[model samples]
Target: MKKVFTIIVLWVAVVGSMTAAEPVKLLTYNIKGHGMTDSRLDDIAAVINAQTPDIVALQEVDNRTFIGIKHDYLSELAQATGMHSSFFALVGSYYGVGLLSKTEPLSVQTQSFDPSDTSKDKEARGFLIAEFEDFYFISTHYSLNADDRDTATAWAINFARKSDKTVFIAGDFNAQPTYRAMVTFKNNGFSILNNTSAYTFPADGPTSCIDMIISYCSELGQEYDVAETGVVTSVNGLTLSDVSDHLPVYVVIDPIEESGVNNATETREMRLVRTSGGFSLSSLQAESMVNLYAMDGTLVDSHWVDNGEEVCFPASCRNGLYLVQVKNGYQNSTFKYILNH
Candidate 1:
């Protein structure tokens, strides 16, 4: 009887271990030219570091060459946070979008709407699409032109519908929810965050709610939960500041798992260290499988590293932290490490 009871307990443990809850956290911000002189970058970094989000989407990222400071805003943040990042210039010197993730991306692509027509300024602006393990995410800044805005909206929907994976779309869309473009996108499967009327732009007045985030399922049968959503609000009674005439939006999502409850365990004492090739697995045990994923939550690689095994990452590995998942039988663990140049 004791042996049978032990067997039952072990079975339950295995089932629990196999059930892993990996929540993907996302943030969208329009950091005004990296907040050049206001010292807002420090505040922005503080907020991001505190959230420790898995992915971040940024708009108005500077790419101008003449800027004496770091011209690549996203790259600088990626370096500061040890996360992999990508950027797309929507308007060259004026508007751009960026994606930063702690996980390595499978592929990065950019698309610029029709630039031939000068009337379509926003359409001339481009968007960046990032592919992670089982999901695809995009960021953009829409054109202020109404026709271009509508066209851009349609273009985004068309792309989302054709994607083979789950999608997360975020950026400064420049259109209210009441706008036809916003409505049409919602009619499809996109669920927007902050529907409760959030004030996002101009920083001071009451005109918020344009900067937005929305998500859609990839396949016909899969399910998703909005989980949690909100504005970054203010830290120490100070708002996102006048950095870009916009505020930051954030959302956390839980993708449905097939078997048991999906919950994450608290990761304590987690630290990322630079490594040649890649990183080493220290204090990890044998008989455990490890999965390396990009910030968009895409699995880049998986294997079994022997207990206390140290393996060098591939040279082509980009600079960023890789989400490391360690699983033994039914129980699981997660950690992150950074790669630097």
Candidate 2:
């Protein structure tokens, strides 16, 4: 009896160490070209910082198109949010989909899928997968056609199967939960997070739940347990208020240390993504002063501005990283951001 009790205690200790309770946060957002102007990257970062997600999937990204003012929104995002960014160019066009991770991903991979059909106007659809410590994360925006979605679904499942690790996918499917594409995911062991009937598009008035977070863990050497999942609504009274056409979705996964990948690659930074109407800072009081400083503690710019105003950084500002300090009386807040040109 004494030997049996010792063995049971040993087993319990092993399992307890294998599965830590700290959950990993995940978020998905379709930022509508990540906002219209170059300066808006900071605003988009603000939206992401507010969520404090460990990983994020984004769709409808503009790399460097005719109308896109920024040369590489991905790098700017990396600067703005200080997250490792990856992009998958769809149809060889400037527009595409991609992902960002709080931790430097172990690996990044991308593949184009048959969208059933493609025309000059319709860009090809694709998926980007990032390898983290224990699980694999994939991001893809599905085609508008039923046949295309079916094709993408099969490809995604095969791709996930390539790795024995648990896999989670998040993006805008452009289809309802009852669609055949979703059914295929279900049949292949993928389950949608937050199956509640909450809509995600048409930011002013959402009517359908097109955005989804799907996960698959099974007998093929996969293991994961979800802590919680839900839709991310707007940040009240901030620059990101009503920022995009669709609302973001998020999830928290338990035992994040299972695979021995520590996501603490860097310190968390705050970014302010712009709203459709433009940036708005409701937290600052009237007569607040703003100062921009380099990481080396060199004062670069200083100015006095009113609250709820959009302060666009001049193009002449040297590129790299900067510390943005907002001061009102004795209260002050500082933020770090990358400024890759």
Candidate 3:
């Protein structure tokens, strides 16, 4: 009997490890074409190497354009960092956005924006979608004009809604948090992964927050939890401001595993509702271990609760985004909630 119990324990451990998912690190930067000189390429590559990101999205890259130094910026950067490269031209096959990955993407696609709705004075813009094993990574740059930004936001959201897998959209949006484009993303079930409080523009002396990373998962109760995120101000004692006008933003995401439970059924059975003071859970089928976490993966509270129980935030808790996870022997579910006074 002792030997049989020992064997059972080992089997459970193996199964648990198999079901666990790995975290993915993503970086987004707007490297102005003027800053891509031969001398500065090493500094930019060093910053990327220090981060060790699995994938990178870049904007304003040049590809042997006569207007610039006649150098392929994307190719040189990829060679320096030992990564595969893909570019989509937004301006006459010369200047555009690009993507670099440690592993080659399974597929690539591009969408061109229609300039009909945009102002005549604004330039054309578009996005690139790189499909990997588990998710789609989109690279984009929005117009500086408010109306143009609004049109681009609507187009991107429509594309994301058609995807069946998790989607990550990152770029220099050229709009602040208070802009309508940002609000549309929030209202359409997308979550901002980077720290919005950290300003990323005019890298020399930043004052406004324009660069951003946002994510969306098609399933209702399924979402990627943010493990870590920040704006890269400096790397290896080299100030990044010397490399570009916009700082790079990165986010590490923990993908939720979909193995042992019926996600569609389990999510439908559980509900999270907000009340006047706090939140409450209803329709729970079993005794659950409830855990609440802040946006940065900090466990704010944990406790055991039965059906129709209320979970109150600590008085010191500020107004921000929070996650609620409820787990039991047979089922597990997670939900996102925002607290506002």
Q: Which candidate is the best by TM-score?
A: 3
- In terms of lDDT, model 1 sits at 0.66
Give the top-scoring candidate (lDDT). Answer: 3
Candidate 2 regions with alpha-carbon error over 4 angstroms: 1-21, 65-70, 118-121, 220-222, 239-242, 256-341
lDDT of 1 by residue, 1-341 (tens): 99999999999989886666577888888777643642555566666776778988888776543354445556667877778988776654444778899987899999887644657452466678999877888888877776777777777788877887777788888787768767777677565644325567777664758888776664542344455556666666356564456777876666665444332331212112223234433222124577888788987877764321234555666889777777765446777767675
In the range 166-205, model 3's lDDT, one tens digit per residue, is 8888888888876899878877767666666667999998
Give the true-structure RMSD of model 2.
18.5
Count of residue pairs whose backbone atoms collide, per candidate: 14, 11, 0
| TM-score, predicted candidate 1 vs. hidden true structure | 0.65
The TM-scores, one per candidate, come to: 0.65, 0.65, 0.71
Better TM-score candidate (1, 2) = 2
In model 3, where do residues sit more than 4 Å from their true spots?
A: 1-20, 64-69, 116-121, 220-222, 259-341
Model 2 per-residue lDDT at 183: 72
The positional error of residue 302 in candidate 1, measured at the CA in angstroms, is: 50
User: What number of backbone clashes does candidate 3 have, counting pairs of residues 3 or more apart or in separate chains?
Assistant: 0
Ranking by lDDT: 3, 2, 1
- Candidate 1: where is the Cα deviation over 4 Å? 1-19, 64-70, 92-95, 115-123, 220-222, 237-239, 259-341
